[model samples]
Target: MTGLLTDVPVDIDRDAARRAAAEELSDPKYRDARPNFLQQIGQWLGEQLEKLLDGLSSAVPGGIFGLLLVLVLLIVLVVVIRLRTGKIARAAKAERAVFGATRKSADDYRRAAAEAVSAGRYDDAVRDRFRAVVRALEERALLDVRSGRTADEAAAEAGVLLPDVATELRQGARLFDDVHYGGRDGTEAAYRALTELDERCRRARPVAMAGS
Candidate 1:
């Protein structure tokens, strides 16, 4: 009773310590092992099915019916998971379709256009400049050009976000179509016009709606 340890007093708030530990374990930012929602849902469904089957096995007094029920439940779970996964895949594919299959960045296309201008390949410059415009619009979420969409379609969509440049965008889109699809050679003036529109759009900001 007279030991040094007994002579010294220690204070511990047991409830506070327990609460701190619980918070540390439950906090999302600190918890490193969070379960995926889909996987957790599947597991919970399986558990519920297992309990139902157990009750059925006891009440119905037959192994065959329980086995059949388990199989049906498993098939249903598989179908649900597959449908969810397929929907997610389709959404991803749709987003990718908006931007098409180009790996080049907007800056890359813009630089290519400048190089084409220097080489006096006015048609090529026009083509690249129009591509740069589309890429920029896509990056800015101004246009959502899906597969098979024409330059005019892209320009029209972008015009909703940038109405001030609608006329120039339409003109630039026509020039691109002419040089690319209509077998017409592009002139410096045409390429210069596209370049000017591209610069304007790059610097332009969206206008606020009247009522919102």
Candidate 2:
């Protein structure tokens, strides 16, 4: 048993072992260890930030162009809306003027008829009176008297409240039309009819307003 133990060679190279260990420690691979997980994540984050800055620098011109396009479109939209609003306002004003003119015309015709009857200017009275009534009815009632509407047609559209004076009103229009268009002579009867029609229009004004 002693000889068997002696036969087993015990390697006692302590100095060599220590030298090998020191050399390994001094090697660059051993001295510079791989970074830990936290350090590696920090390095990766820095690289990504650099890449994002590069992308932003490259896209600056395109971003500016897009902004300008949006601004131009906004300006055009504002101009179009302004022009449309202006047109609408003008149309409203024109409608008001037409209505006001129609009322004034009716009053003028009534006054002219009264003046002619008082002055005994039968021919002039009949003509001026007829024109006044026609202007009023056309403008106020929106009737197209210019296309040569008959006296009965004009009276019906006038809707003058005085149905009792309908005949006299029609007669006045007929006399005016005959003398003005048909070259017939104006007379005393025509003047009388004009005066009666004017009186009827004054009475009927309230009813016309109600209907309107």
Give the alpha carbon lDDT tens digit for every residue of 96-143 in model 1. 232356546789988998999899899888888888888888787776
State the RMSD for candidate 1: 21.0
Each candidate: how many clashes?
0, 0
Over 136-211, each residue of candidate 2 has an lDDT whose tens digit, in order, gives 6565553664543555566665645546566666676678767655667667777667766765665565454567
All candidates: TM-score: 0.50, 0.37
> Highest TM-score: which candidate?
1
lDDT values of the candidates? 0.79, 0.65
Give stretches of model 1 more than 4 Å off: 1-100, 208-212
lDDT of 2 at 81: 80
Please give the TM-score that candidate 2 achieves against the real structure: 0.37
